[model samples]
Target: MTIQWFPGHMTKARRQIEDKLKLIDVVIELLDARIPLSSRNPMVDEILKGKPRLVLLNKNDLADPKATAEWVQYFADQGLPAFPIDAATGTNVKEILPRVKQLWAHKIEAMLRKGINPRAIRALIVGIPNVGKSTLINQLAGKKIAATGDKPGVTKGQQWIKVGTEMDLLDTPGILWPKFEDQMVGMRLAATGAIKEELLHLDEIALFVIKYMVQHYGAGIQERFGVQDLPDDMDNIQEMVKVMEAIGRKRGCIVSGGKVDLDKTSLIIIRDLRAGKMGRISLEKPF
Candidate 1:
């Protein structure tokens, strides 16, 4: 399925971010830990214009630890410091300010030499919709300063939040690019809830999730749903359908005539995957 979602507000958000970058000391680029690369907005590099950025792989609690490690190292190789954090639980969220301070240490030191106290670090937090950007900001500020929700496009405007006396965070609405050159990227984003569910075909997203889980997380899926026999062929559509039906039966998502409700089943599978009920799963790995 070809999936694309770029609302008019996103264009306005991009422009707003550009206008605020001059006053910002660093950019906090949040990403979904399960699908790091897919959740990353490609336009960020172009828009930030080489501003120093720290990558936080949010929702690491729901991602395979092994995959998260590989991703952290992958970004390290690219000269970006990437950390695994769960904003909801506030795990590793406190470290963000210190790290941002580290990035702007030189500027701070220069101010100190001139007998000037360095002001709070001005940081711009950005990411695609539902990637946990606002959640992280709220965690850092010790209160609910930014609007957050499970669905995409929740934060419409930008606001500056004081993260204690150490940093000032500019919380911007999540921005997605105009188009996705690779459809799989869109599929991954959809599976991870970064894209709005209304804009996607639930069956296609469900199948994509099933195929990936079957290939990379076979035992996890079986154990989660209590399915004994699973098809090994990822390319077999019928086998995948059977798997879905089995899960549907297990979850009691049945319709009239005893037929499985594939649409409801799709929602269940996606919800389970996102809620970490299927275990710590990473949809993609560093290659």
Candidate 2:
């Protein structure tokens, strides 16, 4: 599918971020733990060059723990400090301060050279929509410091939030790239709720989720849904139909036409999976 989605404000946002980068000591890039590489904007690598970076894989509680560990190692091998955090529940939030300190050691030394006791280090939180950027900021701030909502684009302008004694957060609105070059990347982003629902094909994305689950965590699916005799040669669409039929029976999503409403079934399955009701499943493996 040729996925075409780009908002008008993104150009302005990119320019603004480029302008703001000169004033920050470190770039704290937030990525969804479920699909880190796909969610990351390549422009960030270019714009954030020469600055220390901390890649926080947020919403890790919703992703597979094993995959999260692999991603941590992968980022570390690439010479970046990476941490898996669940911003919603504040898991592993305390570790960020020390990591930030370690990343900005040179800046700290520069402060000492100026005979100035640095009060706080400034960092920017950036990510695509619904990647838990505001959630992370609120977690680090220890309060509801940033306006957070379930939908994307809730944060419009930039806001500075005080996270701790010596750390401040620059929160920006979630921004999507100009175009998705990889089809798999687009599908993965759609599956994780990073892309707007209206722009996606629900049934196709649902099938993708089913296929991913069957490949990576089929046992989990069988255990959760109590489907003992799953077809071995079934494709993703067929597996999705099985899941939809089961869910339709469970939720009584039957129409007057005596057929399962695939649309409603798809919505139910996707919502449950995204909310971690199905189980913790990660879509991508660490490189």
Candidate 3:
């Protein structure tokens, strides 16, 4: 399936972030804990080049704890300080201030040499849409400094939120790359609600989620839906049908003819899974 999604504003946002990079000492980049590799914007590396970086695996509460640990290690292997955090509940947020200070030790030293006592380190919170950047900032700031919502593109412009005496956060609009080159990356984004629902095929994305879960997660579907194990030869669509039927029966999604409403059932399952109702699920393993 061809995935086409490039908003005109994203181009302007990219330019804006590049222009603002000079004003910050560090870049605190957030990636979805569930799909860190896919949710990461490739352009961030080039755009924020020469800046100290922190890779925050946001929404950790919704992801598998073991997988979250692996992702932190995977990023650390690349010489980046990564941490898993639950932005909504404020878990691990206390670590952010200290971590940012540690990551910017060189910059802090430089300021000390210049006689800037207790210099405030400026950090820009960067991430793709719906990755929980605003929520994280609010938690850090201890107030509603940035507007947040469930949908993508809630942040329209840049704003500075002072967290404490030593740290200030620049919140930027959620950005996506100009194009998604990989089909898997596109599907993962869709599955996590990063891509708008109107832009995706619900049934197709749900099937992808089901196939991945069955392969890597070991019987999550059978356990959750009380369905028999899928046949070894069963295809993704067939397995998805079984899952939909089970969910339809459980949720009472029946049509006039008493048949399970496949479309409605598919949407319900996808929504629940994305909303973390299906349990702590992670889409990719650390490489």
| lDDT (CA) per prediction | 0.84, 0.77, 0.78
* All candidates in order of TM-score, best leading: 1, 3, 2
Candidate number with the higher lDDT (2 or 3)? 3
For candidate 2, write residues 141-248 as lDDT tens digits.
777663544449775655667776788777553354623578888888877777765687888777777777777888866766665555565564675577757766
Model 3 collision count: 0
Q: What is candidate 1's CA lDDT for residue 125?
A: 82
State the lDDT of candidate 3 residue by residue for 8-97, as single tens digits: 666776777887787888888889999998888777777778689888999888898899999999999999999999999999899999
Decide which is better by lDDT, 1 or 3: 1
The clash count of every prediction, one per candidate, is 0, 0, 0
Point to the candidate with the largest TM-score.
1
Model 3 TM-score, 2 decimals: 0.87
Lowest-sum lDDT 10-residue window in model 2: 1-10
Full candidate order by lDDT, most accurate first: 1, 3, 2
Alpha-carbon TM-score of each model against the true structure: 0.89, 0.86, 0.87
